[model samples]
Target: MLRKIESKNMGSSNLGWLRSKFHFSFAEYYNPDNINFGVLRVINDDLIQSNTGFDTHPHRDMEIVSYVIDGELTHGDSMGNKNTITRGHVQYMSAGTGVYHSEHNLGEDTARLLQIWIYPDKKGYEPNYGDYRFNWKDRENKWLHMVSSKDGDAPIKINQDVNIYSLELRKGEEISFPVKEGRQAYLVQIEGNSLINEIELNERDGMEIVEEDILIKGKETSHILILEMSKED
Candidate 1:
């Protein structure tokens, strides 16, 4: 069955400098029924105005992934790592024990991004950081595996058994992937509209899918994030 989490129902925080939408109970937003889906804990879509951002914050026992949609985001962490994440970049920080980090919009225009958190499978491990840039042209027409536990071509590593894919589909394009025998997945439409398993989803809409094989067909030029997970069962 397909169930959608509409954009209007998502918790929102509107500051003069930033606008955010929370997919799960986060910070001051609390919804018992919307706490999380499987190991996926948080999905925050943030648009930060120029010269504004999130200050240094602490996190532990969580895997944080950031995907920038527009402009640039400057990141600095306790690990002595600092970098600017732009469009088509994936940044992963494993705050296993504890870590402090801050993100800011460094561009003249607003910066938009998706910040996702997944509960790590292990606990008390050392904190770590990683990042990679994928040329949009190479992966634009298909699904690109950006994060996973597998050791092959995946760029980001996580302390969990999960796979994350980003796709930029032109109108009329379609994609499909199989869920492991007992696994589940999440389909998040980042932009435009799409149909997954016959269910229509607009921008910022999401679904927790637990069925076997999954198919996605884009109704318009679209960008989507798919997280294939093992903890849903």
Candidate 2:
């Protein structure tokens, strides 16, 4: 089955310098019905004003992924690693036992991105960090695996039975995948328009798919993120 989570239906919060939309219950946006779908626990669309961002915070027992859409984001963590994440770049932080990190907008314009959190298959693993640049040209009209179980393939590795795909499609482009039977998936449109099994989705729009044999089609020049997850029986 397919269900649409309209952009307007998302929970929002405006904290002056930071404006965020939560696709699932996050922070103060609590909803028992929308806690999560499969192992995908959090999908937060964040737009940070220039010269502002999130301060050092602690996280544990979760796999966090950040995708920068525009401008620059400077990341620094307790692991003694610091880096800049720009458009088309992804940063992953495996908060196994515990970790503290901060993100700052390093551009004059607003920095937009999606910060997603997933429940790991096992906890108390060693914390780690990784960042990589993904070429849009290589993924044109195709799905690029941006995150996976193993490292060196997608730059970022997480401890979960999940894979994340980033796709940039032309107006008439399309793609299909035979998902594992009995698993679930979540699609988040970061920009432009697209259609999943003919269901229209705009910017910041999301959907939870419980059906198998998924076919994703884009209706325009669009940027989309798909998280394929393994469901627990």
Candidate 3:
């Protein structure tokens, strides 16, 4: 099964400094039917104005992942981990029990990023923070293994049985992924345009896949993100 979600159809929130599009129920965009996809709870495509950002906030029992698309995102947490993640970099924070953190864009250009929240397998795990700087060339024309439960090629590890992959496909390039039974996937077009199994997807557009193989062809130079996880019973 496949369901395509247009970018404009997503829930939107426009604060003075922060503009966001919610892929699932988030903040004020509550929709019971659109709450989540398996263990994936939230995907907030955010644009933060220069010199402004989210102040220190508390989170618990959630696996938070941040993918910086443009500009720079500065992160600071109570754990004394502070870093600026640039494009092609990923940041992960497991708010097991509880944790406080802040995200800000101190650069001159507007910062664009995807803030994702996934439910942990169980609560009360230890809180942790880490990040990885990925080389852009590694994902060019092929999938780049980013995050996974089994820690081998993936640089970051989470507490759930999920795998995350990214790709930067040049025009006319194509890639395929097999879908095992009892598993599902969510895909998002980060930049440019592409066709997922012949369905067109523009920037910020997304689709949910279940029990079907994925074939992605780049109509133009495209950046894509895929999250595959176990299907909920």
Candidate 4:
């Protein structure tokens, strides 16, 4: 099963300096029937104006990942770690018991990012934070393995049985992904346009796939994020 969600159909919030599209029920967007997909809880597509961003915030027991799409995103947390993540970079945080963090765009241009939240398999683990700067060329015309529970070539680690991939494709390029039994996936188009199994998706569009393999073809230069995981009961 493949369900395509148009970019404009998702709930959105515009707070002047900060604008966001929530893929699941978040903040003020509540849809009980659309709360989550498998263990994937939230996917927030955000654009932060220059020199402005989210102030100190609290989170607990959630596996958080942020992927910078454009400009730069500066991050600071109560754990005393601070870093600026640029395009093609990823930040991961395990808010086991609790943690406080702030995200800001100090650059001259607007910053775009996708903030994702996934449920942890078990609670009360140690809180931590980390990031990886991925080479753009690695994902060009193919899948770049970003995050995973396995320990081989994945750049980041999370506390869930999930695999995350990043793809940068030229026009007319195609890629195939297999969905094994009892597994599902969620995909987000970050830039340009593409077709997934013949279903058109524009920038910011999202799709949920279950129990079926997927073939993605780029209609134009496209950047995509994919999250695959075991189906939740």
Predicted model with the maximum lDDT: 4
lDDT of 2 by residue, 38-100 (tens): 788888999999999999999999999999999889999999989998987899999999999
Clashing pairs in 3: none
- TM-score for all predictions? 0.95, 0.95, 0.98, 0.98
What does candidate 3's lDDT look like per residue over 3-91, in tens digits?
A: 99999999999998999999998889998999999999999999999999999999999999999999999999999999999998999
lDDT per model, in order? 0.87, 0.86, 0.94, 0.94
Instruction: Say which prediction, candidate 1 or candidate 4, comes out ahead on TM-score.
Output: 4
TM-score of 3: 0.98
Ranked by lDDT from best down, the candidates are: 4, 3, 1, 2
lDDT string for model 1 (1-233, tens) is 45788888899998889899998998889998888888999999999999989899999999999999999989899999999989979889999999999989979999999999999988997999888888898668788989997453577889888899998988888888776667888888999998888788999988877765778888998899889887465
Better of 1 and 2 by lDDT: 1
Give the runs in model 4 whose Cα sits over 4 Å from its true position: 150-153
Off by over 4 Å in 2: 151-153
Which residue runs of candidate 3 sit more than 4 Å off their true CA positions? 150-153
Quote the positional error of residue 45 for candidate 3 in Å: 0.4
Task: Provide the lDDT at 198 for model 3.
Answer: 98
